[model samples]
Target: KFTITDGRIARIETDTSAGDAVRLGPALPGLANVQSHAFQGAMAGLAETRGDTGDTFWTWREVMYRFLERLDPDMAQAIAAMGQVEMLEGGFTRVGEFH
Candidate 1:
């Protein structure tokens, strides 16, 4: 909880009875995934395979590019939303998506 005064932060307090407080319910403290390729989150299960030459970074890149080719702006937005939701559920409140 907090008591603001004249548009500046004033008394800061933790209140058990705060009406709008979000209860974490045994969850760990939120963490940040500092290097997230959030777009990959959407294509997670689809790219966990090896190519004929065996998997490499180049192979993964190709798969990611293919995923992008089929993704329009709206689809990308939805996918990003899904990633954000997953991150939050996994106790990550902040992320830096590389895509």
Candidate 2:
């Protein structure tokens, strides 16, 4: 465990002995969710249903753009908060929201 006091790291301790616990498992760094349209989480499965004759990235983008038109600052913040929460729950510590 480690504790930060004021502007510096103060105390550090370990529960087990030095060689008792070797690094065996994969060391996974926190994921950076780069390039996520924050508001799309709400609409993830919405377009998977029946749509026009052919549904492609362009078609999905059109739907996403329509959703974007409805969001203001507050809505955007709310969406970002929700997205961040979900990302953290899924082991992602940082997210790079792409507009």
Candidate 3:
């Protein structure tokens, strides 16, 4: 059993009766994203095209460089915020960002 206070887990114990406890189904620990380029999330689906060279990692690197050249601090923060929201919705409780 567990007790929540202020939207956080306050206590956890086993072999106790659940008295007036809310059942939220079987709970799984939230996952952590160990490696994330949050800024690159803003380019989702924008680099999937097959170029004349047939889409190599070099091509993608070039695209990313161009994107980064135009990204300012505010834009990076906004993209990171959006990525964080997406990560939470996707069941990530923590993130280790690469940028």
Counted clashes in each candidate structure: 0, 0, 0
Task: Estimate the TM-score of every prediction.
Answer: 0.65, 0.65, 0.82
Candidate 2 residue-wise lDDT, 1-99, digit = tens: 444468343765677455544544554557788886767887788687768778888988898888788889898888889988989889787788887
- Residue pairs with colliding backbones in model 1 are none
Q: Write the per-residue lDDT of candidate 1 for residues 1-99, one digit (tens) a residue.
A: 655579444676775567875554552445999888888877888768675777788888888899899989999899889989988888788898885
**Cα RMSD, model 3:** 1.8
Superpose all Cα atoms of candidate 2 onto the true structure and report the RMSD in Å to 1 decimal: 5.4
For all candidates in order, the CA lDDT equals 0.78, 0.75, 0.87
lDDT against true structure, model 2: 0.75
lDDT of 3 by residue, 12-90 (tens): 8898888888898876678999997888888878798787877889889999999899999998889999999999999
* Candidate numbers, best lDDT first, in rank order: 3, 1, 2
- Between which residue pairs do clashes occur in model 2? none
**Against the hidden true structure, what lDDT does model 3 obtain?**
0.87
- The prediction achieving the highest lDDT against the true structure is 3
**Model 2 off-target regions past 4 Å?**
1-27
